[model samples]
Target: MVDTDSVTGTAKELAGKVRGAVGDLIGSDRDSVEGRARQVQGTAERAYGEGKDALRETADRVADAGADARDNAGRYYARAEESVRNAADEAYHFAEDAYDDGGRYLSEGRRAIAQQVEESPLAALLIAGAVGLGIGLLINTRR
Candidate 1:
């Protein structure tokens, strides 16, 4: 009962077809001609309404597609942001592990050097002298 033009026209067209048939059966030329004219008018009106409906449907679909694209873009951005955050966390943890390893190595090296110096003071002194001599020679060459 929305009374869309297409529905109204379709009803009229059916009525016209029935009237035309009845007129033909009863041998009334005037009634038959009028019914055929009405049928043609109804068909034109129905076609016009159908064209409008098609255009409206196409517009609605276009709007929906635009909305869907925007939503998909938002989802993609969120996923990319999450990926970046996860990668940063992984990189930070990796750097922290490396820092800890470096600290441990430095501590071990210090302990080893202290032990060596305590075990042999004379050898430690000799090694220190050799290092100083080497540095002096390098500097003299640069000069």
Candidate 2:
């Protein structure tokens, strides 16, 4: 409509102008008035068609922008999900390592205590009695 209709309307206007000029040259008042009316009508129709075409183009651009924004949002959401999963995996591995280290430390502490007790049975027995007395006192206070 923008291209074809505009061109047709322009052609009509030009033709009307030429006819009006010719009528004026020949002194035909009726033909001159008719030609001037055609020129005015053609101009109005051309403007209307051009306005419609401009509105259509604007609507298309807006739709395309909306689609592009939606696509970008989807990609960003996927990236955020992947990042969360990766962080969780890293945290799990870290916790596993810490648990293994704690187990090793506990084993070493038990062995050390056993060796000390073997080297000094009497001293270990006295220490154990003292620890038991301290625990009994704490329990009595809570009660």
Q: What is the C-alpha RMSD of each candidate to the true structure, in Å?
A: 39.4, 39.9
Instruction: Give the clashing pairs for model 1.
Output: none
lDDT of 1 at 32: 61
- Return the TM-score for candidate 1, rounded to 2 decimals: 0.53
Candidate 1 lDDT by residue in tens digits, 62-101: 6667887656655655565455456545544554555466
Best by TM-score: 1
TM values, all candidates: 0.53, 0.49
Candidate 2: lDDT of 117?
100
Model 1 misses residue 59 by how many Å?
A: 22
* lDDT (Cα, tens digit) per residue for candidate 2, span 44-88: 445444544554555555556788765665565456545544654
In model 2, residue pairs whose N, Cα or C atoms come closer than 3 Å (at least 3 residues apart or on different chains), thus clashing, are: none
